[model samples]
Target: MKKITVLAGDGIGPEIMASAIAVLQATASNYEQNFQFNNQLFGGAGIEASGRALPEATLQACYDADAILLGAIGGAIGSPWEKAKQTPEQGLLALRKALNLFANIRPICVPDALLPLSPVKEAIVKGTDFIVVRELTSGIYFGEPRQLQETKAYDTCRYTETEIARIAHKAFQLAQTRRKKVTSVDKANVLATSKLWRKVVTDVAKDYPDCTLEHQLVDSCAMRIVQQPTDFDVIVTENLFGDILSDEASVLPGTLGVLPSASHSENGVSLYEPIHGSAPDIAGKNCANPASMILSAALMLRQSFQEEKMAQSIEDAVFAVMNEGVVTPDLGGNAKTDEFTAAVIKKMQS
Candidate 1:
């Protein structure tokens, strides 16, 4: 049995988590796979349980699991978590640090049925199926030698050749499984870190000579993503630029409620979750969309377990269900979360 540590976080998290789990169970039965679901509290629930967003026991379970499925994290302002020594978000950062999670993958695939709802034109985003591989553990986000003061405030942006190379290799390897093209986005013309990023990535590209590599200025690359969404296959960049670019790319999918993300470490363990936040106001409403969480579970199967057929089955069921006008409130449909989940499972089982 594949051990999956499940973190049903705050707000709409638990509800969507239930949906994802139901879909996963259905997929397991259909594929004849055994998944051991390990439930754990997180975010605000964790705070309530042990005054911490990631309890000791929860982290241990995650360490021992095959892959992790997380719904979402964080709590609303004025919650007790805000008053804690470490906020719920801090726990996430700590977990990332502890696990040595160095890569963040966000695939911005626009379904054909949702192109009309996307900000990009149907002509542009109709076939958009690209993934962003963002370096999570290094670069500006974790760089130090900085200070914040009344007059002088500065944060250093740094990167090592190894940091740039490993993430580049990851993108290239992913591209080998996709369209075999990688657009390395950077401000190499201006930033010192990006100069090294470009240099190191260019060197790494030689290792995978079968994959095509092109360096794009972050500015023009951002513009191109909007102008020509399909021109991209895989995008690799440092932390700060990628954080912005991935969020920018997320718009191609229409609603954030349908986007899934994964964070990978050197270890085989990875964590999958939706890119959307905790809709605290909608907690327990039974109207929150669960497609993103369910798709995230599919990503877990594909990325962590290499269960391509099972993963694609879940993804196809989601696309089919959505195209049938069966989405939840986030997609402008009135169907309850369970209704949408049931539709996906029914589609999967059939």
Candidate 2:
């Protein structure tokens, strides 16, 4: 049996998680697969229940599981936790660190039906399919000596050759399977860290002689993503740039509600979650879109379980439902969250 740690975090987390789980259960049942799902509290739920955002029990549960499914985290922008010494996001960061989930992968694909919904013109977004392999554990977010003072507060952006090589290898391997092209995005002209990034990635590329490599400044990469998104196949970047660019690329699919993310370590342990955060306003309303969460489960099936057929089944079901206009409020449809999820499950079962 495949073990999964289910963390239904905060806000609309429970709602979307319930939907995603329903679909996951359906997939397992139909495919004669066994999934042992262990539910654990995390994020704001953890704080409220035990005064800790990532309780020890929760961490232990995740450690024992083969994979993790996260709904969402955080609460309202100016809520109590935001002002507290410990915030909901700390739990997520801590979880990633403890799990050693150094590689974050986000796929961006624009469906034909949602072409009109994207901010970019249909011509640019059409046939746009690329995956961003982000170096998650290091870079500015985790760099040491970050300090705040009266006037000269500063944060460091640092990376090692080892960090750059691993993620670059991952990106290249992924590219070899797809378009045989990997675009390494960095500000090599300015940032010293980015210069090291470019150098290490170039060295890694030599090993993957079958894969083509190109270097682009993060600024131009950002512009090209909107202008000619289809030109990219696989993009590998550092943490801060990936964090920003993934969110930007997600919109090309028409909504952030449709984007899922997977963070993995060198080992098999990985965490899956929708890119969109917890929507406190829609908590318990049954109006939030569950597509991203459902898709995250699809990612887990493919990456962790190695059940490519089951993963494709989930993806096809999602696409079928969306094509039929069976979506929640965020997708400009009247169907409730559960209703939309039910449609996807039905499609998968059929």
Candidate 3:
């Protein structure tokens, strides 16, 4: 049996994750795979229980499991203790670093049924399918030499040859499988780190000669993303840039609640999560959408377990549900949260 750790975190997290677990159980049974899930606490609940955002026990559970599924983290409620020291967001960042999850893959594709909801014209979004391969470790976000003075603060942006090579290689390999094209986004013209990034990625591209490669300045890439999103296939960039671009690209699909992301390690340890936050405004309300969480489970199956058929079944079911006009309020459909999840489950069983 494959062991999996489920972190049903704050707010709408538990509700949405419950739906994902149900789908996974059905998929595993149909595929004749034995799977066991071990639930653990993290985020706000973890902080309240253990005085730390990421407890040692939670980390151990993640290490022991074959894969991890995380619902959203953080909550609007502030802890009575040191606010900065007790925030739940730290738990997520700490867990990511501890697991060595260096690659984050975020796929953004506009479902055919939701084209009308897209801000972009239908013709521009008709066949828009692309994936963002982001370097999760070793970049400006975690770079060293960060310091704050009495009046000013500074953070260093750093990268190594190996860090660039690994993520670049992943991007090229992904390009070879998908569209035979890769766009390396960097600010090489301005930053020394990006120059190193450009040099290293260019060197790595030679290994995958069949995969066409190009480098674009980050500013221009950001502009073109909204102007001509369909032109992109696979986008590879550093942590900070990828974080901004992926969020921007998500708007093309109309709702942030519909996107899912996966962060993985070299040894196959993976964590699946939605891109959106714990919207404290809708904390206990059933109005929050669960599609992103369900999609994250699909990514967990595909990237970690290598269950492509089952993963595709989940994806098709989601699309079919939306195509039939059954959707959450966020997607402009009348279906309630339970109703939408039930539709997906029904489609999966059918």
Each prediction's RMSD to truth: 1.9, 1.4, 1.8
For each candidate, what TM-score against the reference?
0.93, 0.96, 0.95
lDDT of 2: 0.89
Estimate every model's Cα lDDT from 0 to 1. 0.87, 0.89, 0.86
What range of 10 consecutive residues in model 1 has the weakest lDDT sum?
84-93
What does candidate 1's lDDT look like per residue over 1-350, in tens digits? 99999998888999999999998887786678899999998887888888888899999999999998998888777877887665778777777777888898989999887776677778888899999898988876668987889988998898999888888989999999999999999998999999999899999999998899999999999989888989999999888888788778877876778988899998668999887888887888999889889889999988888989999999999989888888777677898999999999999888
Error of 3 at 313 (Å): 1.0
Ranking by lDDT: 2, 1, 3
Poorest 10 consecutive residues of model 3 by lDDT? 77-86
Error of 2 at 54 (Å): 1.1
Looking at model 1, residue 258 earns an lDDT score of: 90
TM-score for predicted model 2 compared with the true structure: 0.96
The local lDDT score (0 to 100) that residue 175 gets in candidate 1 is 97
Q: Once superposed on the true structure, which residue ranges of model 2 sit more than 4 Å away at CA?
A: 150-152
